[model samples]
Target: MKLKMYFLLLALGALTLAFQSCDDDDNDGISVPAELQNALAEKHGNAQRIEWETKGTYYVADFYEDNYEKEAWFTKDGVWQMTETDIPGLAALPAVVKSAFESGRYASWHVDDIDKLERKDVETVYVIEVEQGKQEMDLYYSESGIFIKEVADTDGGHNSEGYLPSDLSAAVRTFINENYPDARIVEMDVEKEMTEVDIIHENKAKELLFTPDGTWVSTSWDVRTSDLPGAVTAAVQARYPDYVIDDADYVETKENDYYWVEAERGEEEVHVKVTAEGVIL
Candidate 1:
């Protein structure tokens, strides 16, 4: 009986060690690089409950900051790439961004989720996921409330290697070169009804739309509230004295150009569309 009890105790010790080893390898059976760990610590000082994994060519860290879930991506050399954080609700969004969504084309769609994306050397973007019937889409908006682009939610995200410039039609390329001489195409997306292209011009990001046949639809970019046209600003102030212009978008279409301004007062929000000549639309 004494011999049997000793053997049982030895087995229990081994079992405990096995369990401990598994607890240490909980990060998907992959070892995180020391450099990445240090980089994460430096960037997100308060990050907690971190789990590291290899995502394609980058190291991804899933963790929590200030009780909110976040994911940070880093290059193999430990350079920070991007970070995405879960926004609790629409109320947590910036006033300008929220107002834009409430008045935009997809306003009636059911919002399923929202995230804030921060990338190095780029403007911050808000991503709102909305669904209607069997269709789902992810809309990207700049911090200043300018609509960026929308992509169908397939596989839950967008492809990093979007359409290449070489994939563009000749007419589309000609239009861009003729109109935006200094612009450089950065990304492109082709849909059923229209093709969308993202470009950088004069150090600012802009989105251009074209019909399937390569006819120019519109071009839009963020505009500072203070930089709005005098007539447009005056009209907004005259119409809504209690509201302050927070952000605006200058949209140039084939037929006309207008400013989409977001105005706010306390918790009240409104979107005003005005032509350059101050005609309210």
Candidate 2:
């Protein structure tokens, strides 16, 4: 969706930590069960990768390759907690993810992102959304690694248009705009069949799915100051429940930024501060 906001002509950046491993660090012991390890390796060994992280007292499983990545979370006691490439909450991960990663179906594919999807009530599902060029392939999976669904251009991928699958995150879009403002976005199309568009300029930057009618969508504008991502949005809303938006503006070439929201309740007046991340009460 195109995010509309006041443009102020300033720059803002939000930093989130990501795991880095230039060389596979197989030196660590398995935090996951031996059975689980064997199962994943046996199936996903082709482009299959395994990484671990700690979220609170639990452990998280991260799978990745050249163009995609997926996350599966678990407790130290071998109980599955939840999974998502974005949205930092412990919720049910779709069975399709576990199955696909467990089946080695994407073992040879290097994915740039593992898009996390969700419903109004259910926990988010993991989808291997690979951006090939002008085309995108949304590869769905089951928790046990079964291929559930694959959607792409119906014209046998002959069109130059591309789609954005449901799994995209605010971070992905914000990052692109903040880092690659010069990238040309030719269109913005989101409808019932799919959310696809054409981007003509990226200086050889790989398209999410370069194929015609690429099934990948592009979020092509700056985000509103009030429409930040999950954690930042939550933090601000919780921290500044009383503040009212006096004025909101985004400096051009960036998402939300340097905006003022004034709050006055029963004679107490104060200005709530919001950084690129969230409200700083």
For candidate 2, lDDT tens digit of each residue in 94-141? 554544454654444445345454222122334665545565666654
Cα TM-score per model: 0.57, 0.23
Q: Candidate 2, after superposition: displacement of residue 37 in Å?
A: 2.4
Model 1 lDDT tens row, 132-184: 99889988777778677677887765443222122678998899889999766
Q: Worst 10-residue stretch by lDDT in candidate 1?
A: 157-166
Candidate 1 stretches greater than 4 Å from native: 27-29, 156-205, 208-281
lDDT of 1: 0.83
**lDDT minimum window of 10 residues, candidate 2:** 9-18
